[model samples]
Target: PGFDPAARPPAPPPAAAPPTAVEPEVTGGGSRLPLLLGGIALVLVAALVGVGWILLKQGGGAAAAGTGVLIVGGSPTGAKVVVNGTPAGELPYVDSSALVGSYEVRVEADGYEPYTQRVVVAPGETAKVTVALKPAAKATAKVLVVSEPLDAKVLLDGEVVKEGGPAPWQASDVEAGKEHEIVVQKPGYRDARFVWTPEPGEEKTFTARLAPALVRLRVESEPAGATVYLDGAKRGRTPLDLEQVDATKQHRLEIDGGRCYERWSSTLIFDERAERTVRATLERSPACATRGDRAPGKKRSSGTAPAPRPKRRGKGKLMLNMRGAWANVWIDGKDTGKQTPLINYELPAGTHRIELKLPDGRSTQLTVEIQPNETVKKTVPAP
Candidate 1:
């Protein structure tokens, strides 16, 4: 029967499709299809994730590998190297992908001069630098000692270097461009002095000849009681002198006070052939042992010269021989006569400064004290 449209819709609403065919329950195989399909999808997603992680790690490692490293080598390996002002690790310097930069590199080795270079390294590039080392400087010299009789002493500066030979001396492996002094000396010989400048890697020679010193000394002193010294070394007693000393030699002469003088010193000088006489007149020292009552240049007698008197023969011709000759017979500041021809002079007892002319034209004044009936005899030496 055909139902009305609205009524039929209500009636048919409950008509569930009958469990048409009650089939037997499927086992695990039925659920296995959907589960397996879902599992396959999950496995695919995990594999994709693992692949993506591996790709990411590989990319990071590649970026890290891009960096600049510097390598240095020399004829002598393992030399100390410096970069800029910093001390980089010894020879080969490595960095982790640094930016491009310019650097100054320095290399040093034992017994070699230091070498420096400017280097430009780009990013992701390795730099290789090479350097050649130069040897250090040295100086060598030969010395020839030359002198008369070959007895001179050799000195470097003020220190003694060698003594008494004609030997060959060598100075090796010294620093270059230095000034050195060479001095030679000997007893009775003048000093030989010179200077030398050396160059690097050069061999040089020098010659030196020492000359002799010849001088003389002469000294004298009055009252003759002091000792004399030469250059603080004792030579002799005063009234002391020497001869033929070195001409270029320097000396200091000193005298000591003992009798009538004070201590004094003199600088002696000479030429190639020089004779010099140095004299000292001793005055009465304040510490003199003996005191004098008489003054200097004071005569001890009055004036009246002794002479032979001539007279007529009363009993017998008065025969007499006077000891002194060329005597001036003076009576009160007036010349009476000379005693050479036996002059007659009447004189009274008195003191006198008897002036007698000597053979050498020197007039000697003698002090004479005449007493009554006393005849004094005196002998005169030639001037």
Candidate 2:
């Protein structure tokens, strides 16, 4: 009855312990899944709060640096807008990003009185301006100037009126109750000036009578018949009378009496409507006796002097009728002692020089051939 260690018939393998169900471990709070999820949610909330704070700070900074807006609108659209003396743009102007400041605004248009105002702009705020324009008053006073000489220039208050054209000129917009100077001018004539004050709505007419600016120049040399020159142009023989010389200007007068006499020169000036006489005494040069030229008034016998033509023997009639103005008549360099409208005046049957002299020192000349016993008619034009 001894027990063998390998024998004992594997005593029933100790009942193969029953399979047991595993139970989850429990903390005092709850499962660990819920705590882990709660921790993650807290982390997410903190991140969201940090992002919101950063966004708020950035938005506040942006608001501090914002600009103002300036908008201008008005009647009379398309009118010019000026800000602080600088041209901004047309009316209905808008500046969205304008620096906030005080500005002087002005609006101007044709035929309208200017509108001006001052405005202040604040940051992030709009400054709005509205302008209503008023029309300018029309001038009712006028001045009419008529000049005696057509095409004369007219000047008012030192400014040319009716520029680029003639006078019979009219000036509108003349201020009432104000004295204005009117000047009418033309070349070769004296200027006419007038001062007048016009009444409101009054159209006053002024007449300007201009006078001729001419001088009567008579030049004579000692031994007459010497050549005379005025301002470098030949004016004929000495004892010359020039009626159309310009007044108030210096004129160069030169007298050359052949090669036998010394030349003389002088400067002459005359006033308007003045009669001036220039007398020059020429000296004979010693070479006059030694010159080999022909003697004075003695013609060289060149084939008997070509036999002078016979003068006509019969008389002829001449009638002169002047138009517009009367002038003194001269026949053959002799004064006729009569004005124009000479009917059937008797003259020699030959070519005669007829001169008409006006009162204003203006003259014209004509040559007429008279036929024997026939009347010659001539119409003299006004000077």
TM-score, one value per model? 0.35, 0.34
Question: Scored by Cα lDDT, where does model 2 land?
Answer: 0.75
Native-to-model Cα distance after best TM-score fit, residue 332 in candidate 1, in Å: 44
Number of backbone-clashing residue pairs for each candidate, in the order shown: 12, 0
What is the C-alpha lDDT profile of model 1 across 7-67, one tens digit per residue? 6444445677867778889975565678889999999989977775564343322232244
What is candidate 2's lDDT per residue for 1-383, written digit by digit as tens? Answer: 98778865655556678899999888788757888999999999999777755643432112334568888898799999998788999988998986656678899999799999888666789999999899977546887888766778888899987552553788678887778888888887878889988888998888877766777888777667788898999989978899978764667778887776667666564444456776665655446543243332233454433443457889999999777678889887799998888889999897776767767665555567788999999885453
Candidate 1 overall Cα lDDT vs. reference? 0.56
Single out the weakest 10-residue window by summed lDDT for candidate 2.
56-65
Error of 1 at 307 (Å): 28
RMSD, each candidate, Å? 27.0, 22.6
